[model samples]
Target: MLRSCLSKVISPCQSAFIPGHCITDNILIAYEINHSLKLKSCGQERSMSVKLDMSKAFDKEAERCGSISGFRIGSRGPTLSHLFFADDTLLFGKASLQEAQHIRTILDLYKAASGQEVNFDKSAVVFSKNTDPTVRRSITQLLNIMEVPTHDKYLGLPTVVGRSTSEVFSSVKERIWQKIHGWNEQRLSKAGKEIMIKAIVQAIPTYSMSCFKYPDSLLSDIQSMISNFWWGDGAKRKPIHWVSWDRMCLSTNDGGTGFRQLKAFNLALLAKQAWHIATQPSTFLHRVFKAKYFPTKDFFQDESTSRPSFTWRGLCAVRRYLLSGSKWRVGNGLHIKIWKDRWIPRPSIFKIVSPSDALPEDSTVDCLIDKDSGK
Candidate 1:
């Protein structure tokens, strides 16, 4: 009966504590007992007859708390209570005493049940500029977590608010310079240098590049480093340029070494993200973006606001490339606009007519087809 309960509690994918693998049934029972105790301490009104499952309980409580006292980004779907990536966790809630106390209770319960304590010293609670200091202090004292003046690093990228792309990527530039200084350029052959440049040096700023369109100065700096290294330039000897950097970045079949142009590659990566946003609407990231930026409109039709995030600006900058290549395939003709949408397959023209020439503001392809017949 215990085994059956345990199996139900833990799925096959989460079978970390396998039976007969230095783990006993008593240990599993102890875990369930601990969970019940924690739940009781957390002010759960359930009787002892009910078995406590942490994951489901956590989700339920979080959802309830979020619905009551959370700042929601959109009017659609379930309110985002929390997000977990490996060991890192990000919790979202409205800045209120009730919400803070509820979060504290949940955290304490988790620690008691799992015997894994959160390091409050390492954790930080950041509030918006308009948030009251007194409320921030109260919440800080309640959670025993430090209050940060500004958000620093998230994942690996810097949490850029209004900073320039170059300022945000200063650390990446320093790292690349350090790598170049560490390597012995004279000792490496041309082929060896090319491999290192392509594999290591050029790949350094890829993460940042995917998110933001890099400045010309930064791209040129990186290109210069790779070019110098490839030509075996060192402290004592100066290297000669055999070919222009642009030509060198072209394909081998096009009469140059197969090297990537940083700016082009960065644009391509952002375009891929734009493509995903168009194709994959069910994804969480896609929904979040749709809610925040382009709610009630499609990607191409969405106009940029007076103030947009650096990442959003980057995506919009490369949106033209994606739109230029895209052509709509008429299915029901309800979704495609007659003049605005690119439905026709032609070399020079895709739309039936220009916006000025097209009549009726909300015209669609359905206007050309008979409603009763399946023409």
Candidate 2:
């Protein structure tokens, strides 16, 4: 009976509690909004966001409040009430008393239902500039949550991003340095060094690299550090330079140690996000991004000339890999452009090098497809 009555449980698109979603998804959504608005230079907005570090609380359904249903991300964006990334929840709305009161009422309802008080001390509210101070105080007083300029980090990733790329990401270098320096290199073998590099040092930037492309200078710095750790003995006897860093970054099949080049690794990591967006059309992330960035065209056709967020910028930068490496299946050639879209099963240019004189500008591959054979 339970199986018979089991309804399809649809998750809230805005929430990151759904499967295949992570804390990074939440951070990207929030960061992209501000970046599109050039918020880094202005350091402000007219809205406010409440980051609630709730206790070990279970889920409980509550009556919806129609008066204020959080805030709409952009004109075409979805109305996001709250983003639930694992345990963390961020609520957004206009910097107004009504919204604050609504939030307070919802929290009260939550406390009443769950019988657990929210940790307001750990909670914080970040606002955009030009938000009225009076309204801010009222909201903070009502919720009893302190106001903060930014949330900084959520789930080990930066919730806030600015123009200074290297400065913001300097902590990555610091953590790597600490790990490498703390180890006793004297007792380790060449095999042991390889393990240390692979298991520990190389894994340090996995999360960050998955989100943004590192600057060339930063990648060089990190590469130099890794090289030092690999070559330098425990004591200072002046380690000799063995092989070029680029050569070392080659694959085992290429007669090298298979070290990861930071730039290529970072791009590969960022490609994961691009892959998600390109393939997962039904995802909440796909919906949000599609509405704002590529309403008409798909991911591959998208231009970064639009006021792109840092996340989008990173994705756009890495998109070249997708364009160069992939092609359409051409199951039905109606949608595949003959001259522009990459559909042919050939190298480099996936599209065919057909005679331009015979084809129209809007011609598609359907003409060449055999209707009976379906090839």
Return the top candidate by TM-score.
2
Provide the clash count, candidate 2. 3
Can you write out model 2's per-residue Cα lDDT over 82-125, one digit (the tens) per residue?
66655676776667887787778878877898888878888999
The TM-scores, one per candidate, come to 0.79, 0.86
Residue pairs that clash (backbone atoms under 3 angstroms), model 2: 44-129, 45-128, 45-129
Per-candidate clashes come to 0, 3
Provide the overall lDDT of each model, using Cα atoms, as 2-decimal numbers: 0.61, 0.74
lDDT of 1 by residue, 11-88 (tens): 221223434221111222222222222223222121111111123223345564454243344455224454433344
Instruction: Spell out the clash pairs found in candidate 1.
Output: none
Q: What RMSD, rounded to one decimal, does every model reach?
A: 11.1, 3.6
In candidate 2, stretches whose alpha carbon ends up further than 4 angstroms from where it belongs are 1-10, 13-17, 34-46, 56-63, 236-238, 354-360, 366-375
